[model samples]
Target chain A: MLDGLIVSIDAMGGDDAPEIVIEGIEYFLKHEGKGRRARFLLHGDQPRLDKLLKKNPLTRERSEVCHSPTEIAMDEKPSQALRKGKGTSMWNAILAVKEGRANTVLSAGNTGALMAMSMLQLRRMHGIQRPALAANWPRPEGISVVLDVGANVEATASQLAEFAVLGDAFYRALFKKEHPSIGLLNVGTEDQKGHAVIKAAHERLAESDIGLNYKGYVEGNDISFGNTDVVVTDGFTGNVALKTAEGTAKLIGKFFNEALQGNPWSKFTTMLNSVALIKLKKRIDPRGVNGGVFLGLNGIVIKSHGGTDKVGYSNALNVAIGLAGSNFLEEIEREVERLHDEDDNIGFIE
Target chain B: MLDGLIVSIDAMGGDDAPEIVIEGIEYFLKHEGKGRRARFLLHGDQPRLDKLLKKNPLTRERSEVCHSPTEIAMDEKPSQALRKGKGTSMWNAILAVKEGRANTVLSAGNTGALMAMSMLQLRRMHGIQRPALAANWPRPEGISVVLDVGANVEATASQLAEFAVLGDAFYRALFKKEHPSIGLLNVGTEDQKGHAVIKAAHERLAESDIGLNYKGYVEGNDISFGNTDVVVTDGFTGNVALKTAEGTAKLIGKFFNEALQGNPWSKFTTMLNSVALIKLKKRIDPRGVNGGVFLGLNGIVIKSHGGTDKVGYSNALNVAIGLAGSNFLEEIEREVERLHDEDDNIGFIE
Candidate 1:
């Protein structure tokens, strides 16, 4: 009886496999997915999925189980996963999308393995030389989209330009903004700062009239400050910046905990401020923004945090539904042609 | 009646130069520098420094004004600063060290300009190809030293090794740790992770017996977790990582402030937790760790934050005093000889 946008899921993915996946679907249905006509294709062990589904009637009623013989291990190498990844839950989930059986595919599995398998099965879009993995960053005000977080180790001048177009289009489609401002991640905001590749990209974007509202270069700190809607960078720097921010947030959380358990007076005061403190805690909770969308692909594939619980997984599922329902795929397709034109006209004077 | 551990001060460098520079010396002498035999040679506009010195009795008693005719502008390019930098406060401060008139030099000026002037005046050590900028990072527990933060854009395999040696020595000298553990900053901690330069450095550091307490690779979060005593990376990545962390901390502080302006109950409770909250603020305050030591040079030069106030400048003065007193200079010199051997023996198989 499920009759809307279908989402294929690798149920055997993540640290707490199958359990969180089933519970996540249940959480999504009762909460954010309440009235939406969204269904899921659960790909995992038949017996395990059956028992878990029985405990959650809503998910069991809406979803159809697609039996997968084997499961991919969390620590398996990408090459090994690619060599023998077929018929596995992760593989079958993507296969559903390839066969047009599902609107999108999602996995909380090994990132390298998933990227490799997704590339092999779904194939790249029209003119993307390298597909980017766009991750959401929680800013002081709202969320900002950062791309090429860890898709490729290095990015060329032309490829950085490609990311700007992809990121700009993706931001506009999801946020429904007429024009989303984009900025390149760099050491400094000045024109002459950072490496050769970044400088070249800045020059190209500043000159080209590709309809992107380019905001020039933004520093690492600017990502958290929400200076731009979308931030672009090479995979190496982006990955490091993302991890560093995560670590800083965790460290402060630990300090906050330790501060509360000090003197009796301090401990008593913390209880008095519990309501405001709770709001502060909820705002910074990592579970709120819990998905990385694999962009420039043939089909929509969301990669949730491997260690996230049911609540976190629900947020990622919400992201999947949000993107799948929008006209993002078509919008990106149009941008790709314009991007190709920009790619051919690079005249680096520096 | 000025005594031991003489530090040359660039009185006309920072945003609020001459004023904070004189007050910072006074603050240091009263607080951390109290009862210690520390003296300063203030380099800047004579009449301004002389007028400011009259306001501070302690600094007036111990410091001597070495009047420089001009000052380096905060945003001056390195090349431009170098071409016309003679007799300027920043230039003369480094010159004082070159002439052996002071034990160390401290500047709160243009970072690029300072680096360029320092390199030219003091020159590199016996085997140092590039001198690194060692910055202090506030951790949950104590502190960590991250190096090559914007000293150079990119680092080769051997240069990274040199950084490790310099960082290890720097950490030991500052913290008084017998064997400080050093970690190479990378996207992942795995042995097979990161770019070719990183992989080569990791292999060399892992196999070499260069008398360093090497802890292999560490991710970005590890820097805040106090997982290692020292974290080393190329200048560009290090600069980005440092700025990103600063921004995250600032964002969290903003959230806490907004959380308190909710309702009357929240406002009443905030006063109760004021003691503990103040303690938490102090724990993450940027002013506490204020200096970036220029490593691999013949002399010691501490770069105070350009925008920092008197309190922050005072902390930078403390760092200058700490290293100037210790044999950090000699320790780095000893390690440089061993690092040269590691550089020549780079047999990168992969």
Candidate 2:
């Protein structure tokens, strides 16, 4: 029996639906042996989940399948879904966290709907001017946390500063880094490089003693390197940049495969250089690190790709466990309080 | 003796300087063979270039070296350097294109400096609103051209429409497509998804006809795929997204190598998957497609990376020749006129 933590998995959330999600959850449970025990609650149509359970026995001892009648489509407007689809797998998963039935929630479908449901259900942490969604981008110096990927399109200087604090907390909790470096994404690294919003935020970050090893301004190209552990930006630019990177990686992979596949000579070359190819694939695979946790929310919430596979879904569950096991909430609260005290001293934003 | 197009390469440009640039020019000449006779005039410190040339026996057969007294620092402000460093390799290379000594100009140096020099020397095309920097991103179907990567940060609706025209012309000419589909990059694909600039530009694009197949709006995630032939945006978002993708690819490459090189078992696995690794590497390697061609200028002006290697420099030279080989200037002029005529008749942009 799992007595360590509780995590709710949206079994019918992703594009491939119950089959992939169920298999992924099973894989995660099997891999995560007896040492780290977490109670798994599957939220979806009970009948469907039961059918899958019959096919594959989940390794976890303590688990339950909760029935959620409805579902939000990938194309549905987030706000509308939150208002109407209250019984959806996504909504139920969020509701579990709200009711203390689950300490964390994981969903691999409809990111917008998940975010909306999370905000509406869990509510934001007190003094969080705006809730931000943080994603982990694998950098040369390990992984960096980038917040405001798509939570709020427009933000004030104070909100950007808040994101930095939250991101620093996240990096510390997950990576166990001390005084993680924080950077503000701008057109250039110069102090006077970006627009008015960024300039104001830069000043705020500089002045604030938020316990961050503030790295000052960082350009778009520096985000991928080990240059900074946390990058803060407005949702518009961050969201676009993240999606663009993902799309570009996929495109490059497709092109590379097509250009070097299906020929005798090509196959021979491929055999000769198989080591490099495997290494490269592992490096760019989004599934290698799935479920970007929605930081700054009351509880741990993970946003996975809508088109995720079985392995991807499984990875999302593991990410939720990581967030919970690392004591993310406690760390964030402490950091938020530290920032709050500093803000109060310097006349904090109301 | 060169019979075809001629391109002036800034030999002193980029981080590696005259050595790598000279080698790149030699590689280009050697690969071009006898039939494709294109002259590459290396512009830099004749003495330094001569010393670098001694490493390789490259006679002035299909290539020549021109003396440029000064060199532009990558970190120097563009406006200040443009006024002071008149005899720099970057400035002289642009001047060569303007003076009809070279049909195209390519540089692996400061992008801002190149843009300033190109704008001052060749001048913007008549009827063209503002010059836009275009980069070709590989996709599943083929490659798509993205415009205004970093030319004008705050662009007007008129400028974006003009970019649409230039991008359409370039896409058609290079891809040899009868009707190239063009998309305006925005937060969402809906008509009213973005701010004032995008809203205004969306209306303008729908009305303007430079023989473009208007594909409405495209989101960031769709950029790497051939959802549209040409993706148009203001420099601010475009530049951030492009650099982010490039940086992400570089980081991914670095991270994988580090992770795989840790142990003997992983190294053996990596070796076995070498074909996949090379295929993946080829996908993300910026050297394969190094430069962003400055469109809407009177002549072909290519902006290579400031930290370009020999292969990257060679690719930039190849891109310049490709631009010069095609009737870019004439087509750009014709497209502007066509767009203007259509806009006038339909009353698109006021």
Top model number, TM-score: 1
| lDDT of candidate 2 over B114-223, digit per residue (tens) | 88888988898999878999998766667788998888766788788889888888887777787888998877775535677778888877865456788888888788
Lowest summed lDDT over 10 consecutive residues: which window, candidate 2 chain B? Answer: B28-37
Model 2, CA-based lDDT: 0.79
What lDDT tens digits, residue by residue, belong to model 2 across residues A1-350? 44778988887888888788777777776774335677778888998888888766763345788899988877777767877767888888888899998889988778778888888888888768788888888766577778888887777888898899889888887778888899998878766466777888888789876567888988778878646899999887788888887887777667667745745666666565556667667777788667788888899998787787867777777777777878777777787888878878888564
Index of the highest-DockQ prediction: 1
User: lDDT tens string, model 1, B13-109?
Assistant: 9999989988898998889989989888999999999899889999988889998999899999888899888989999999999999999999999
Cα RMSD to native, each candidate?
A: 1.7, 3.7
DockQ score of the complex predicted as candidate 1:
0.80
Each model's C-alpha lDDT? 0.88, 0.79
Name the TM-score of chain A in model 1: 0.97
CAPRI grade, predicted model 2: acceptable
